[model samples]
Target: MRALSVYRDTTGSKLVLDDVPEPDLADGDLLVEALALGVCGTDREIVARGPIWGTERPDRLILGHESLGRVLEAPNGAEISPGDLVVGIVRRPDPVPCGYCAVGQFDLCENGQYTERGILGRDGFGSERFRLEQDYAVRVDPALGLAGVLLEPASVVAKAWEQLDHVVRRTRRRALVLGAGPIGLLAALLGVQRGLEVHVVDQVEHGAKPRQTRDLGAVYHSFMEDLSGTFDAVVECSGVLVGEAIARTAPGGAACLVGIGAPHGAGTVNLGELNLDLVTQNKLVMGTINSNRSHFEAAHQALRQIDRRWLEGLLTDRLPLSAWRSAFDTSPERIKAVIEFDA
Candidate 1:
């Protein structure tokens, strides 16, 4: 089995694709056969901006974290098994958090669980047979196909809902998802799934972007108007500053920041007026770093029912792993991109 990794030398240079050896599974780990893997905004950043390579011990690394696939083996009586379709999370939680494993918040284990078993950096799932923790492998119905396979990516959005209660410790359910990118859309859609009237906002033209939000019952907004402190909670996955800066967070409302985009140089929280007001107000503002096993499981469970036609539309283009250079170099409006493996 072979895999594609993004490499940056010790001197810090642009990323290059490398075909490397497939990873071997450790105890409590499972081997998965890759099917359809989506290129994430994070992956784009690692390639174009190089934030991820900088996180790893070395800059050189594999570059995919969003993926759906089938399981090939499961040790003992683990919940996963061969032939079971699955959606996998890229980040792992640190086990040393006071009680992450005890409380099931392993994803947030403070010591280091979430970023420890990264799928693409040193243990990524971009290869034909990638090994990952069994706990991270949530089962998906095989019937879902490529679209249903998105359970993991969709789960990335599900993690925000877990925090909704945490954000609004005591408040109503009105919610806002800023940015409308895949995660933003998923966040907005998940809010709607839980009966919250969600407002999806972004400055970008709808363009050829997949309109899945409509199906999930979220009303799209262009952010051309003032929000006027309307939402009880806001999850920021748009990766832009203004969304955080201009967000109309109600008093006591909780805000979740989930995007990767940042201002150049000493990136400040360019929250416009909201930044100054948030301090005096009793609002709960937090930065959620990554998703955990429960998030991965919950996300996969909900995504199993997703409409493939709609999900596939999320894909803006399909590039072979070998064509990665052209995929990013061309830099077209790639809404969703997948690197299909050759049989």
Candidate 2:
């Protein structure tokens, strides 16, 4: 099987299109044929900096986390069946299985010992075929087709909204989503689905980001300064503007920070003023990443209810496995890039 992998050693690291052996399934694992894999910043970072978490042989790590596949074989009595579409859950609980992990809330792993597929410690679904434990594979609606590839990222948005619901006590009428990437757009879509007025901000003023935002019946802005009035809910998908996004939330509203921004060497924030605003307004700000099964299931439901055409629009680029290098291009016009495998 041909797999996209990252090879690292004491000398250095590099991306490799290695011809590896077929994965051996565990007792309760399902063998799935890869359909499509979503490319994101994390994959690019790993290609550039190498794997940070894995077994002794980090070089063996596969480099994809967002996955979509079709079951080729399943164990008897498993909830999934052969030919069913599925997405693999990324995080696995620690060996100790902390209090949160013990209850299946491994997304909130307390000990930082969790292993993430194609990420922290395990091989990912970045090949022609991969193995997923029955318990960690979530079925996708066949109706979604290739658009189902969006599920993994949408699950992250689902978890963010889930947390926001717990923090905000009042009715949410308006939402502000910072950044217009896949995560930001999906965040806005969920806000629209919830009947809130959605507004998206991104630096790209004349491209698909703004057009897609408008197509969803949400307003789009080129700069945060152009957005007027505070929102009951704020989703900061641009890691660079956490403080600004939080400041734009209305009294009693909450902000969910989703993006992991790059470090600004000498840049500083006025934490004292930010703290005062939060204290005086009774606001809440929180960060969320990865998702549990419940979030994936919720995201599945959300996708089912969305317009297929609109959902498909987010997938601006789809290339064959042979053209995988092109799929990594970060052009403004490209929203979500996918690599399709030969069936």
Candidate 3:
């Protein structure tokens, strides 16, 4: 199998051409042929960092989290059959308590975890062919289109909405999606579908800014250089230190931080208007990591049912796997860039 890999601990060292062999599998494993894979930010980050898959997570494992592939072989009792189109999720649940596998969240399981599959795991089948646990594989209808192929990330947005849905049942009605990136836009889409008065906030470009909100169906606002009162709820995906800003959620409102950044680099947030000292406040600040399988499933269905043409603009570029470096180094104006595999 020909795949891209990283040797030594450098993001730029991502290997593009290699004839790695197919992996041996256990009775519970399914071998998949990767057709198209999404290179997320971490795909590049891990390449530059010193954490080897096996050494830190998996010894010399492959890097890739959001990917779509075909099932070449399935073990007996596999949930998937050969030749099925499937999306691979990054997190796997341990049948037992693998620390961090808390109820309502199982992606954090640290023990008995597979050596492969997510971006930072022990093992990843980052090749034309790879092995995966049957349950981790999400089946997708081939008819969903290359756009439908976006179910993996779309499901992530679905998962974020699911979390908000649970909270809306009790409190909070409005949502402020804190970035205009793909995740924020998708989260905005789900918020609109679920009947929330959603507002998407981001820094603007000179001309292309208007179209982003026009397609999103959500009211768009620029971040607080034009400051105002607090929003009812917030979903911060701005990719900066948004945690503190999320802490400023309105009373009885909630804030969801969907963006990840460095440890000490967390952003500054003003709390005076959060009304902590001025009034009785009931705010909920939350954070979400990776999406679960249920999220992946729902995202596929939701995206399929939507018009998705606006998403065409969201996918600013499509590059071949060979030119992975160019795409990684140049991703400022882009929201979501895809790597088109063999036709």
Every candidate's CA RMSD:
3.7, 1.5, 3.5
- Model 2 lDDT vs. the true structure? 0.89
Residues 1-343, candidate 3: write the lDDT tens digits: 7776666533334445577767767523787777776666677677666344445533355656667788888767766899898887766565465556655256545564533364544455467777777767788877665564467667767766777667744555667777777777778877877777777767774334346666666777665544355666677776673754554466666677777877645645456754562256666666776777778878877776667576556666677777666656644466776766664
Instruction: Judge candidate 3 against the unseen true structure and give its global Cα lDDT, from 0 to 1.
Output: 0.66
Candidate no. 1 TM-score: 0.81
The residue-by-residue lDDT of candidate 1 on 1-343, one tens digit each, is: 5665655645544655566675654523787888766776666666665544435447556556766777777777877878887766655544454576557666566565345333433556667767767666767766666665456567667777787765577747688888666677667767876778887776655654325566667767666374545678788876664345334677778777777665652155546555567766767777776667777777766665556666666666777766765545423234566777642
Q: What lDDT does candidate 2 reach at residue 193?
A: 92
- Which is the leading candidate under lDDT? 2
| Model 3 segments more than 4 A misplaced | 9-15, 52-59, 75-79, 94-96, 99-105, 108-116, 170-172, 206-210, 226-229, 241-244, 268-279
- lDDT per residue for candidate 2 within 1-343, as digits (tens), equals 9999878756667777889888876513799999999998888877777778565554578879899999999989989999999999999999899999999999999999998888878888898889999889999999999999999999999999999988887888999999899999999999999999999998887978888999999999998889899999999997888877888999999999998878972147788998899999999999999999999999999999988888889988888999898877787667899999963
| Stretches of model 1 off by over 4 angstroms after superposition | 10-17, 27-29, 49-60, 76-78, 93-98, 101-104, 112-121, 169-173, 226-229, 242-247, 264-276, 279-281, 326-333
TM-score ranking of the models: 2, 3, 1
| lDDT values, one for every candidate | 0.64, 0.89, 0.66
Candidate 1: C-alpha RMSD to true structure equals: 3.7
